[model samples]
Target: MSCKVIDTHSQLAYVVRMIHCVCNNINTAKVDAAAARGAESAACVQRACGTKFNCGQCREDINHRLAAWRALNPMLEAAE
Candidate 1:
């Protein structure tokens, strides 16, 4: 077998899927779009798209991804 190595300490945002909270259609891009449009609340997304959240398996991952994404794009505060 070939050996492969990756640096785990380094963080990255892997937006594997668009986060469409069924209660709201809040996808990954919406957060940025919302911020661009001057929205700071996840609820605003909920109000707009019904992405209020459900099972939450994705919640922790979403939060972490949002943080990772934000770290890379530091000018925007995460709307999570």
Candidate 2:
């Protein structure tokens, strides 16, 4: 038998809080933080989080999280 965990942030398995880069122990929260701070691209997120590409598996996931973060915090800039 097998069981799967669901994150409260999303019904989808790809929620950003899930680990995105095992190589650097980077999760969606870190990526989203970077995006919230104006890191516009995946490379920016990587740089902000002090992580590097290892297996290249996380690039797409990071990008997805970045977009979501931007959408969630669109008003963040106005408060700054």
- What would the TM-scores of all predictions be? 0.42, 0.70
lDDT tens digits, residue span 1-80, model 2: 89998767553433525887888888877887887788877778888988778787888888887777766667885566
Model 1 TM-score (2 dp): 0.42
Best by lDDT: 2
Per-candidate RMSD, Å: 6.4, 7.7
lDDT of 1 by residue, 6-80 (tens): 787453333434664544456677654554454435555444454565664544544554455556665655443
What does the lDDT come to for candidate 2? 0.76
List where candidate 1 sits over 4 angstroms from the true fold. 1-27, 31-48, 78-80
- Using TM-score, give the best candidate's number: 2
